[model samples]
Target: MKALKPRRFGWWYVAEWRLRGMRSYRWTILLMTLGNPVLYLAAMGIGLGALVRVDVAGVSYLHFVAPALLVSTTVAEGFNEASWPVMSGFRWQKFYLGMSATPLAPVQLAMGESVAVSLRLWVQSFTFWLIGLAFGAFDGLVSILIVPIAVGAAMATHAVVMAYVATIDNDVVMTFMYRMIMMPMFLFAGTFYPLETMPVFLQWIGWISPMWHGSQLARVVAIGLPEPGWLIACHVGFLAVWTIGGLLWARRTFTKRVVV
Candidate 1:
C-alpha cells in the first residue's frame, strides 16, 4: 500500500475531485438547485394550499409542508447521489478503484465521498430554507434549524444507500428502489400530509423513514410544534443508528472491494 498522505489533504483530494467533476454542469445544477424550492413551494404551498384553506398542524398548509419538503428533498438528493455515482465509481468509470491505488484507503474514500455529499446537502437545504423565508413559510430565525435537520436526513440516507451499492453488481435494482421504495417513502412519509391522516397500516412507513424523523424534528425546531420528548429522542436515536450502522457496513464492503 502507498504511504498515507497528510490526513487533511487526503480527504480534500477525494472531495475536491468530485466537486470538480460537478463543476462541468454548474449552470444546470444552479438552475435546478434554486428553481426546485421556488416551484415546489409555489405550486404545492400556494396553489394547492389555497383550496384546502385549513390550518394544518396549527399552521398554514405552506408552513407545515415547507420543513417537510426540506427534509424530503435532502433525502432524495442523498439517494440520487448514492445511486448512480456509487455505481459509476465501482462499475463504469471504476473511479474508486483508481483512488484505491493512491495513498487513500477505502475508508478514506468513503468518508470523503460522504463529505462531498454532506456539503451538497447543506447548500441545497439552505437554498430551500432561504426561499421558504421569502415565501413567509418559515416562522423566523428558529426555522434556520431546517438546514441541519435536512442534512442529517441526507447523511442517513446516503450512508445506507452507499453500503447497499457496495454490495451490488449492477444498478438495475436502483430503478426498482427509487420507484418501489423511495417513492412510497416520499409520498407517505408525512411529506404532503401528516401521518395521522394516513391509515394505520401506512403509518409504519413513516415511522421507519428518515425523512419523517427529520421532518418532525424540523417542525419542532422551526415552529415549536408540540411533540413528546421521548419521541424526539427516538427520532434522533434512529437517525444516528442508521448512519452508524450504514457506515460500518460501507467500511466493510469497501475494504473487501478495494483493499483486498
Candidate 2:
C-alpha cells in the first residue's frame, strides 16, 4: 500500500481516531440515543399533554413542545460532546499533545473532532424525529426537517462550547457552565413555553440561545408555526454565524494550546 499521506487528509485521520474511540462506549450512546426520546415523548407528549387541553402556539401542546424538545435534546448532547471530550484531549488523556507530535495540525484535529460530533448529533436528532412521529407529535412530512434543524443547532452549540473548552485547564469552569449556562438556557429558551410568556427581562435568554433559534425553525417546519419570513431568515443567519465563528475560534484556540 502507498504510504498514507497525513498532510493531505489529516482531518479525516483525526476524525477516524475519535470515531473509533467512541466504540468503547457504543452501548451507552445507543441507549441514550434511543431511550431519551421515548421517555421524554411519553412523559411530556402523552402524560403531561393530557392536562394541557388548550392549544399552545396554535397547536396541541404536545405538537408545540415536541420540536422544542427535539432541538433541546440535541443541543444538550452537543454541549456534552464538546465539553469533557475536549478537556480529556488536552488535560486528562493528553491525546491532543500526542497528535501534535505527529504531522497532524491543531486545526485538523479541531475539524476532525467537530466532524465526529456533528455526525453524532445528526444521528441523535434523526432518532428523536422518528420517535416524535410515533407519538403523533408532528404535523406532516415537513416535520422531518426538524432533524437537520436540530443538527445545525447542535453543531453550532458544539462549536461554541468546544471553543471555550479548548481554553480551559480544569473542570471548574465546565461545572459552572452546566449549572449556570446550560440549565438556564434549557429552561428559558422557549423549550417548554413561548418566550413571550416569560418575564420581559428573562426573555433575552431565548434571543441569544441556539436552542431557541433551532426550536423556532423546527416548529415552523414541524407544525407550521406562524413566523414571518424575516424572522426565519434571522434564525438561519444566527446559527450560521455561530457555527462558522465558533469553528474559527476553536481552531485558533486549539493551535495556541496544542501547537505550543
lDDT of 2 by residue, 142-258 (tens): 889999999999999999899989999889999999999899999999998899999999999999999999999999998788899999999999999999999999999999998
What's the residue-level lDDT of 155 in candidate 2? 91
Which structure among the candidates has the greatest TM-score? 2
lDDT of 1: 0.87
Judge candidate 2 at residue 87 and give its lDDT.
98
- Number of clashing residue pairs, candidate 2: 0
lDDT of 1 by residue, 1-260 (tens): 23546454677788888888778777866886798899889998998899879899888899889999888988998988888888889888999999887778787777778888898879989999999999998988888988998999889989999988987887688888999889999999998899999999999999999999999999999878899999999999999999988888888887788876
After superposing candidate 1, which stretches have Cα over 4 Å from the reference? 1-9
Query: How high is the CA lDDT of each candidate model?
Result: 0.87, 0.91
lDDT of 2 at 21: 91
Worst 10 residues of 1 by lDDT: 1-10
